[model samples]
Target: MEETMSTRRRQFKADARQLLDRNFRFYLLLFLPIFIIMIVTAVPQWMNGAGVDNPGYNLLSLLSIISGLLTVGVSFVLIDLQRGVAELTEPVSKSFTIFNRGAYLWGAFALEIITSVFTILWSVLLLVPGIIKGLAYSQAIYIYRDYLDQGHKIGFLEAITLSRKMMDGHKWEYFVMQLSFIGWGIACVLIIPIIWVVPYMNQTMANFYVNLAAQEDESDEEPTVVSPVDDADQSTTESKPETPADGDEKTADNDDKTE
Candidate 1:
């Protein structure tokens, strides 16, 4: 059991290191385009509407909304890339690069957009429900990486189903793990040109999912043993047995003594 746990820790570390190394470039590649797009669309409008006469400040307000929307969308893409990093790195090389860039981006965007709409509505009820829904749908990227990348069309329902199954008995554990990263997140929000919190958060969550998936696989591979009888029956079977020869000899001795 100790050995099993140690091996798991090692695997987790390896996966994490690999994610960090690859994600440095992956997130850069992901965010650059989105950032450029957001800036190009958002900045001018925001600056133009900073006038005091602009009562509603439509441009600034709209730019903020647009920026937020872009951030969320870009985040989904980044998370998707992190989820697929393992598979992406499988074929990495100097001369040849990875593929599925388009599929990964678009699929994540679509799913996230759909789920975000649900989250928007869900968020209306109460803040807690929104957070719960966010966490529940958090595995969308992992689901896409594992299932959808293999040419499978696993839809929203399957994604939720698989995530729930993987999360069973481990939800609070994940929540706590997420909580542990809050400090890192806050620190990132304070720093500039050191933006790693998003990637870190995404990869950490992916790592957690990977761990859970590995556990489920191990459990499925292991065969479980079940006993048909009670402990008393087991004890009886394990007890010493009398030999036929010994029993006969005892009986003969008794008869002779009687004679």
Candidate 2:
């Protein structure tokens, strides 16, 4: 089924619920440390006039790279965990897992740098174009996995291109979906222990990727069509008949003369 924003959110909740049913503590632990780090990272923004003011480009850049790497890391883990396809669950702590994944961790950081720089440059000229481009390039990580699995040789620009293509008609819906989380995010920051919001948001985005990827997969697949001309029965019926035997032909002639 094609998912709307609300339906995709519901689907993620349902998936999260099913996952919780397996091992709530395990899944909770999957997010706890990262949540703590998020809080830690939030401190500076809170100190800087609650993020209304800038904290200079250097600190912000480092934080962006680290945050982006961590985000992609957690996302990679959660997606694998959701499908029960990865052995990454052993680490339990997502912070450690992010780096432990080796190439995955560094690769995400690399992607983050390129995507962020490009998106920021795009935004420098115009805000709307930047936001649109931001949303467009946002799916690169998810698409990265797809390209790797499908044997598509994906470099930075190719990934961004594919992500943009996947997001062509769905950016507004996704933007609205992210906007819907604003209140919950605020509530979580206020309450602190309501850390479930992070994973929920991440999972929702992951689910969104799954939905979008499924749509792309469907689009790429050509429907199997059965042509009557190609059917075995139809071909047999249309085949040329065999010639009559000599004796049988003479008997038919005699019978016809008598008639």
Candidate 3:
């Protein structure tokens, strides 16, 4: 039986929690540098008050963009961890794996720019549309990773386009899945809890992508359909021929009648 979206969402979170429970310390260690990086980039902006009029706002914005780009790497790390493909012994080194590959680095940069521009454009119309569009594009990085895995060198826009398609009929579900982490988000306000919360949230999100991809794979499968003509042809091919005994009996009966 096919699972409903809500059921899958719940399962994704539950599975994530189970995985985290086993490797909570490892994930916490892995997320430490990322949290620190975010704090380093954000603190100055927060202190200075980010605004158009501020002189350092542009610099801070650049830092923020860089930080966001780094998250592309973090996403891969969490995904690898979730999928059990990563080396658990070296979480810190594995976290920077995206930077070692030119494809991942540039692809992430392009995706970030393109999606941000599109989301900002949508926001021009209204806040809700922008949020919705952001949700639609949420899977772009994961889709891009999939394309790379399949050896397809797709452009960033292509990944975003595929994400929009992949997210069809599931944007609200994704949003709700995100909202399910509201308690974790609230806990992060204490700062110390952010290390654990960020990793937990990211792992759950990775699980969400896993579930979404599984559904897409299932949906892409073409069910075998038997046509009436084909079935009839098959039946005719399987029909039994007359046995030698039956042919001999018919000949003997004819001969007997003649006699």
Candidate 4:
């Protein structure tokens, strides 16, 4: 059965909690790449002292893009980890290697560029367009990761295209789903809980992708809906006993009295 989004979300939270309770360390290992990437991405800006008069990341355009791409690559691996393909049972040493795979890494880099360009283009039109586009492109990361993991050669734009299709009629729902996380996000600002929050959020998102994929499969099946009119028509076609006419009944009664 296809679950309502709210039901799926509640299940996702329960799953995340179970994952955390069973092995916090392993989940933390999954989130390590994201934390490291974030710090690395921030360092250059910090060194340049953004508050100063000439404040900006003191890096070449190419390097800055590479940094952003690397962050995206790590994020892809994090998704893979939550999906359990990255091998949770192994040592923490193995956790960091998933993102380093050449195909997933390069694919993420290209996917990030394509989505960002289009998102920025939409933003130029109006803020709402940009937000909607961002939601539309949200699934690209997971699509790319899944493609690479399956040992297929996927083009950069194809993943984004597939994501747009998968997200059709789903953008606003996705937006609201993310909005529901705002409370947890605010809690993460306290620093200590961030480690746990990050992994939980990652796990929830991966589960969401799984649900989305399943829903797509169900849609492809084209489930049938039975209408009331169809039921009435079918009932009328069934065999039934005929009733005696009024004149035939009166004649039979008179004949019985004479006998």
Highest lDDT among the candidates is held by which one? 3
Model 2 / residue 49 / CA error / Å:
6.3
Looking at model 2, which ten-residue stretch has the lowest summed lDDT? 250-259
- Superposition-based RMSD of candidate 1 using all C-alpha atoms, in angstroms: 20.7
Ranking by lDDT: 3, 2, 4, 1
Give the best candidate by TM-score. 3
lDDT of each: 0.49, 0.61, 0.66, 0.59
For residues 1-259, write the lDDT of model 4, one tens digit per residue: 1256677678877886786778888767655655665667567666657654433445445555654554455454444455555555653444444356777566666667777887787788777666777777788766666645544455556666556666776666666667878898998886548788776776677666666755654564321111222232433322211222433311212211110
Measured with C-alpha atoms, the lDDT of residue 60 in candidate 3 is: 66
Off by over 4 Å in 4: 1-3, 36-56, 59-86, 91-99, 221-259
- Evaluated at residue 7, the lDDT of candidate 2 is 79
Q: Find the number of clashing residue pairs for candidate 4.
A: 0
Q: Which runs of model 1 end up more than 4 angstroms from their true locations?
A: 1-31, 34-106, 120-125, 189-192, 221-259
Give candidate 2's root-mean-square deviation (CA, Å): 20.0
What lDDT score goes with residue 234 in model 3?
A: 41
Which candidate, 2 or 4, would have the higher lDDT against the true structure? 2
Error of 4 at 242 (Å): 58
lDDT of 2 at 33: 58
TM-score of 3: 0.75
Model 3 segments beyond 4 Å from truth?
A: 1-3, 49-59, 190-192, 221-259
Sorting all predicted structures by TM-score, with the top scorer first, yields 3, 2, 4, 1
